[model samples]
Target chain A: SQTIHQWPATLVQPVGSPLSLECTVEGTSNPNLYWYRQAAGRGLQLLFYSIGIDQISSEVPQNLSASRPQDRQFILSSKKLLLSDSGFYLCAWRNGGILGDIQYFGAGTRLSVL
Target chain B: AQTVTQSQPEMSVQEAETVTLSCTYDTSESDYYLFWYKQPPSRQMILVIRQEAYKQQNATENRFSVNFQKAAKSFSLKISDSQLGDAAMYFCAYRSTFGNEKLTFGTGTRLTIIP
Candidate 1:
């Protein structure tokens, strides 16, 4: 069975600080990875997605960025965080072979920017 | 561009009762996919159910089922015998079949199961 793991389950970072959130998947290779954000009482917003290594597509223009360093390792980073950047971040993966494939999500990382 | 709409921001239902959460989407593409995701208090996005645009029959999973109307562009989720564990935020999402894997999500409906 495939599983997704995200680290720093919860974080409290000061404003303008650098941020890094990692996501890794097991039991699958060449999977489609995605990064999403959910503000309080808001819907899941797609921030970035990668079909392959070094192929990140950003949906929203913001301070956050994403990278796929390995086949199953994805990272979300920000040089300087903003107060609006505080939210629950989710990592998702889908089978690359299936078009419009269903996505499986990780436990998510809750970031509180002060 | 595809858009998903979930009108109800909050909903409450007594335990063991049935409730239907409505979701509608607008898409120019004839072939696409619709999905319902559950975000619990922990804020984990879990896939609850999914419906393919080409399929005519509704999709069901245990107590959860989707009323899919492709022509109407309506996809409603019906939770039968709702349980306390069902309390969460439900979101409707859409993905185009033509190489767009990014899901466009709705505002979500917070379902509260009353004891």
Candidate 2:
């Protein structure tokens, strides 16, 4: 069985501070990783997705960025955080195989920017 | 471009009763996938059901099913004998099989189960 892990479960960062959220998957290789953000009462918005180690796609233009350092390790980072950047961050992973289309999500990280 | 629409922002139903949540999508591609995801108070997304465009018959899980109308471009989820655990934010998503794997998600419908 494959599982995804994301941390820290809760984060409080000051404005203009750096941000780093990590997500990793076990029991699968070369999986598709994605980053999504959900505001207080708003729906989730896709921020970034990566098909491979060097292939990353951005769905929205924002202060956040994503990277795939390893086959199953993905990281979301920001040089300087904004007040608008505060939200619930979710990390998802889907199988890269031909018959895999279902996406599995992690516990998520709650970031409160002050 | 593909888009998913969940018109209802919130819905409530009494426990043990049935309730239906509607979802509509727009896509030019013929082969694709539609899914219903449940985000409970815990905030973890759980897959409820899935439907493939090629299948004519509707898809059903234990207590959850989807009414898939390809021609109508509609996919609605029906929950039978709703329980308190059914209360959550339901999201509809779409993904094309033509090499584009990014999922386009709807805003979501918050379902509240009354005791």
Candidate 3:
């Protein structure tokens, strides 16, 4: 079985502080990783996705960036956070080799930028 | 680029009744995928059902099923014998077979089940 782990469950960071959130997958390799953000009452928006290590694609111009250091380890980072950077962040992994595999989501982190 | 739309922002349904949520999408591709995801208070996304545009038959999963209209570009979800646990924000998503394979989601419909 494949599972995704993302942490910390909740975060409170002051404005202009650096941020780092990590996500890892177990039981799979060469998986496609994605980062999504959901506002208070809006739908989720795609942030970044990586098909392989060092092959990251940004969906929109944003304050954060994503990196896949390892096949199963992905990190979301920001040099200086802003008040608008606060939201629910989700990490998802998909079986790239499978035909109809669904993206599995993590527990998500509730980021509150103070 | 693909787009998904969920018209109803909020809905309430009585227990054990049937409720259908409407979804429409825009895409130029012939073959693609559609999905319904549920997010509860925990905010974890759960896949309810999925449909392939190439298939003519509708897709069903337990009490959840989808009415897929490929020509009309409409995909609606029907929940039978709704349970209290069904109360959540239901999101309709679309995925392309090509491109980066990212899911394009709609503004979700918040379903409230009346116990």
lDDT of 3 by residue, B14-105 (tens): 99999999999999999888999999999988899999889999999999999999999999999999999999999999988766568899
The reply for model 3, stretches above 4 Å from the true place, is: none
Name model 2 segments beyond 4 Å from true.
none
Worst 10 residues of 1 chain A by lDDT: A95-104
Against the true structure, what is every candidate's RMSD? 0.9, 1.2, 0.9
Cα lDDT for residue B67, candidate 2 = 93
List the lowest-lDDT window of 10 residues for candidate 3 chain B. Answer: B94-103
Candidate 1: which stretches are off by over 4 Å?
A: none
Candidate 1 residue-wise lDDT, A20-107, digit = tens: 9999999999999999998988888899999999999999999999999899999999999999999999999999878867899999
Candidate 3, position A23, lDDT: 99
Model 3 lDDT tens row, A15-35: 999999999999988999999
For candidate 3, give the lDDT: 0.93
TM-score of chain A of 3: 0.97
iRMSD values, candidates in order: 0.9, 1.6, 1.1
Residue pairs with backbone overlap in model 3 = none
- Listed models, DockQ each: 0.84, 0.63, 0.70
Model 2 Cα displacement at B71 (Å)? Answer: 1.3
Per-residue accuracy of model 2 over B1-33 as CA lDDT, tens digit each: 999999999999999999999999999988899
